[model samples]
Target: MGSSARLRQFVHDNGPLILDGGLATELEAQGAKLQGDPLWSARLLHTNPQAIRDAHSRFLLSGADIIATVTYQASIPGFIRHLDVSAERARELLMSGVHLAKETVTRFDSGHQRPLVAGSVGPYGAFLRDGSEYTGAYAAEMSVEELKVWHRPQIDCLAAAGADLIAFETIPSIKEAEAVVELLREFPDTTAWLSFSCKDGKCISDGSLFTEAVQVARRSTQLLAVGVNCCPPDVVEPLLDSAASLQSPDMSWVVYPNSGEDWNPERGWKTSEKLSATIPELSHTWLKQGAALIGGCCRIGPALIAQLRRELKGDCTPAASAEPS
Candidate 1:
């Protein structure tokens, strides 16, 4: 079956798809020094690929139905400029991210369900290596076509590498989301999901209403799901609530929020007081709100993902605090 059909079938058989938790977070826990690196976890695609594979394996063991590849900050230009490799080699590295995740899935024994690999395509602001990804300030300066041009190469490489789907995640603006949705036309066979970095219950990072942002998903028939990621867990319900009436019946809501902690560009993730509700608690609410795909983001590790799987399977017996232990 094609990717779109495969995803629909999975969601039909499964109540809600379980995505893996943070990749970079798990990698750091495994001893990969990613601080201040432009490549972030993508650098490991070349430096320590085994670390990336190990991370994927852990999420799989934790019961993730889908494991996204470590390409969220990877791009041809960024790799060439930072890793100092030729353009061809950079593309190879981008493809390697998908290969690593696929390798892990092929070796795992998940009983009746086969896990999928999503090639992560982060926003253009991520390429800036600044906090623009959260603020989306760069979207104001770049045209939709320019954003599409910047993202085309990475999407091409990921699709060619045989990723099950393209994860256009952490998009902070409507303009970039439009660019990505339109760019999907280039790869007629590829299916993807676009998730925004929300600033609140109602708006994306660029201050555009999420209801408006999700409209872009309607432009592409190939988009499997659309929702928010990397934002605090508290904001997800409101965001989804705000867009609930506007959503298409066929479009699924895919949400994987952070552990309710704030991010500091200079200082990294700032620890917040523990949330009253655990990820599974919040995810249960999200499931009621129509979220078809669920997981965690920053600071959410494999242990938490395992908790999420248990909670989703009706094993809710008061999981430990959602705070990453």
Candidate 2:
């Protein structure tokens, strides 16, 4: 089946999904930079929009069924706070992120069809300088009143750009997911899915149990799928089990774990140092359990996505070719 049809069917059958991440980190590492700037993406957004689209194309070519656009770091608050860009410019960058996806898809998949665009919605705040922890992540600053004021413009920008579906990712808390859902509700035409970041097994960054986040999301949002991203691959097992324990296996669980082995701010999270091991060679075992949707976080690129495609769908031998454990 075509990618869109396959994705819709995958959602319908509650089958395995292969979604991709790592574009922003990849682009920034390549030539694009996000240093000391929240809206750090704007400088490279339109000029290097293709860099992200290329990452998407790489994933699609590698067998990823879903391609998350390069909007994870493209948040309004981050832009206003860090980039210090005007509202008009921020909106332009956000729309450009969406449009770049379309441009890439049209160019690469014109005749061949098999990849869906997932408009990425990242944290409202920012990741810590160390990269080991997520920092400044608040969906709302004060009351629901305060939250709405913060999220409106960015949410509207993604909707206007015509995202197939919203991918609210890397949320370490339920409140943030709720905030995103609440913002989405304002627009009758928009649809969204929630994904959380699990710390240990039980709680979010704020210490709310993963179940608390999942249950509230299930009850409150019109989330199409729910799972975790941006954590370590090792964390996947417990996070999935936690969700399943909550009686939510029927709903698809999306996963994109960091390939890194160790994450320390001062030590740095260089791509080479991170994924010291090959994925799915070990990860697909989780696929046997749950993990309908899977991909990589920081430092992961086309090769890993390709391996996932082969392991999950085709006849590629994973354990044999992978480096010794």
Candidate 3:
């Protein structure tokens, strides 16, 4: 079956599709250092591919129905700078992310529901590694066409590499979303989900209203779902409320918030004691609000994904937290 059909069928057979938790978070837990790397976990694609595969395997075993590849930061320009390789080799590295995830899923399939592989395409700001992703402050001179050009190869490479769907995730602006939707036309058969980073319940990180962002995103025929990611859990429900009034009934919604913490470009992530909502609790609430694809972003690991699976399936059995001893 095609990817859209498979997704609909899976949602009908099960509840909301369970996406894997943070790939890089679990990778760091596995002892692969990611500090100061432009490619982040994508660097592991060259240094230790098995680690990426193992992260996918853990999420699958944790009951994730969809596995997003580790290409979130694997842009061609970033690869060239980090790996010191040609553009051709950079694209190869991006394709390798899909291959590693696919290979893992192939080995883990035991005749149950097959998990969909989502090729991750992060924002242009991510390539900068300067925290502009959360702020959407690209160089003022960067034009929409330039954004399209910068993203075209990654999207084309992912589609050509045989991903089931494109995960245009953590998008901080409507311009980038439009660029991706336009680039996707070159590959008619490919479908994508465009999820954004928001500053509040109603506004994206760039200070654009979610209402406006969703309106722009819903114009794309290639988009299977549209919503928020890497935003605070406290803001998701209100963001969903803002989007509910704007989204079409046929359009699915995706929500994968970070652990309600702060990310400093120079110092990395820091926890906040004031944040009380746990991932599993917020996940149930997001589902009730119409999130068809649910998972976690940074700081969320396999154990929490397993918890979400149990919560969604109505399994009350308790499970261990992120760091099980």
Candidate 4:
């Protein structure tokens, strides 16, 4: 079967596939200083790639079926502007994100089912590094074609570098989703999943309805799944209900919400103690709501992923815990 078909079949045979959580979160917990880094976790592709590989391995050992790469902030233009790297070098760094993930998966693939490597193509606001990703305000001046232009090189590098698929994650607008769907035609064989960053139960970060966003994603033949991420877990079931009306049967709903933390560009994550719950306890509710690809986001670590695996699969094997640095 094709990779996309295999993913769907995996969800059908087993329960929902478990996606790995928070690449930057895990990396920061492992002593990587991401604060004020222009490229965020993508900076490790240059200074400490082994750390990136180790992050991927921790998720694998924790029973993640898919590991998203450290390319969330690895756009070529952003690299050129921030790091003063040549376009060629920027492309190499983007490709390195996939290679590190694939290499990590290979190293950790014992006798178990191998995990898929997903190249994370984060929203354009991530490159801005001004918290616009959560509000979609940075993209207000951009057109869909302009968005496509900005995303092309990163998507191009990831696709050429042999990621199992691309993850257009944390998108906050329908225009961005339209651009991603249109960009998919550039690489006919590469499958992708479009996940939005919602602001509330009914709307995306841009205040547009998620139903409209899902409707835009549904236009893509290369899309394997569509849903929300990096949002509050409390809002996922309602968003899923809205997305359900627009998605086809073959398309799965991928949900990996944050630990109810609010991000401040200057101060970083501020957790909500009242909303804090173990991901395992929350995964059951997410699964009940028909989330086919479940996981965590910001402030969620390997221990939570291991707990989810144990709860869902009955495997209590411990993995490397990513303690806060």
The count of residue-pair clashes in candidate 2 stands at: 3
| lDDT (Cα, 0-100) at 115 in candidate 2 | 53
Lowest summed lDDT window (length 10), candidate 2: 316-325
* lDDT of candidate 3 over 97-122, digit per residue (tens): 88988887777753456778999999
Please list the residue runs of candidate 1 whose C-alpha ends up more than 4 Å from where it truly belongs after superposition: 315-325
Residues 67-129 of candidate 1 have per-residue lDDT tens digits of 999999999998899989999999999999999888888877756467899999999888787
Where does the lowest 10-residue lDDT sum fall in candidate 4? Answer: 316-325
Candidate 1's C-alpha lDDT? 0.88
**Candidate 2 structure quality by residue, lDDT tens digits, 163-211:** 7777887776666666776777687666566777666766766678787
State the TM-score for model 1.
0.95
RMSD of 2: 5.7
- How do all models score by TM-score? 0.95, 0.82, 0.92, 0.94
Model 2: lDDT of residue 225: 67
Is candidate 2 or 3 superior in lDDT? 3
In angstroms, the error of model 4 at 242 is 2.5
CA shift at 24, candidate 4, in angstroms? 1.0
Candidate 4 Cα errors over 4 Å, as ranges: 1-3, 318-325
Error of 2 at 115 (Å): 1.5
lDDT of each: 0.88, 0.64, 0.83, 0.84
TM-score between candidate 2 and the true structure = 0.82
Candidate 4 pairs with clashing backbones: none
Candidate rank order under lDDT: 1, 4, 3, 2
TM-score of 3: 0.92
